[model samples]
Target: MRIDLTNIPSEGKSLHFTLTPDWWKSDLDEDRLMGLEAPLSASIKLYPAGKKIAVEGSLSTRLVMRCDRCLEPYGWDLSTDFRIYLSIAPFKGELDVELSEDDLSLDFIDGEFLDPAQIIREQIILSVPMKTLCRKDCKGLCPVCGCNLNMTRCSCSSTYETSLYQNS
Candidate 1:
């Protein structure tokens, strides 16, 4: 999970990692991510940028998620690619100093190591869909009976049917 900065050569390095659900359980739960299905895998490339280290990588995994509409569990495939710049130099002077756009992409390394697992965990959480649905045409659940509209017709449908026939 942690890589030694001293090992990174000026010519750059390529690294791959595999992780399990246990490694991300804490962060996933904090983000309310439910039902992880398989192992997480990633491939990363590190480049030396003067005093800064540049990291670029991609992560992929399968997850079991609940449908927001039907309340049913379903499987989803997730993949994401990201790039970040890391520096060992701490910003000096005032703690409340203002930062420019260039500072936004810069991440300060606390020591001489980088935690790739932590970065992958954050990226996974950010990739989660805002609105999760099992399908595009999901009818959702019946409000009164709490029945799945996609599975069976609820008693409420009969009431509407009777009213329509009575008016004829």
Candidate 2:
């Protein structure tokens, strides 16, 4: 997973690898909201740009995502391309320096080693949707009975007053 910068040839270096669900399970935290339904295919190309390294890659996989509304597991196909610039030199500027638009795409590295696994992991995590839903009209779970409304109707009263703005 770690590539030595010095080993990269003058022209460039290309890497291809398959990341399994087990890899993600071990890398991700205990509260991970997503799972890999299939092995992820990754392709990366590294180019040396003076003191900086340019990484371009693509990832494709099937992910098992939990729907936020229904709390059900659903399959989602993922395919995305990414480009990252790595600066080998550490910035010596002031800590309070403002970042420009170009600086947003740049990453700083301490040593000559690059961990592609970490980059792939980050890309996968960033691809997760903020609001996950299995369907557009998910009924969700009943507040009182905790029953999935999408499956069956609960006998609990549906009319409930909002207590959030109530004067206490």
Winning model by TM-score: 2
Best by lDDT: 2
Tell me the whole-model lDDT of each prediction, alpha carbons only.
Answer: 0.68, 0.70
Task: TM-score each candidate.
Answer: 0.72, 0.77
lDDT of 2 by residue, 17-87 (tens): 99888777533432335678999999999987776667889999998888776688888899999887665
**Angstrom error at residue 94, model 2:** 18
What would you estimate as the lDDT of candidate 2?
A: 0.70
RMSD of 2: 5.9
User: Clashing residue pairs in candidate 2, if any?
Assistant: none
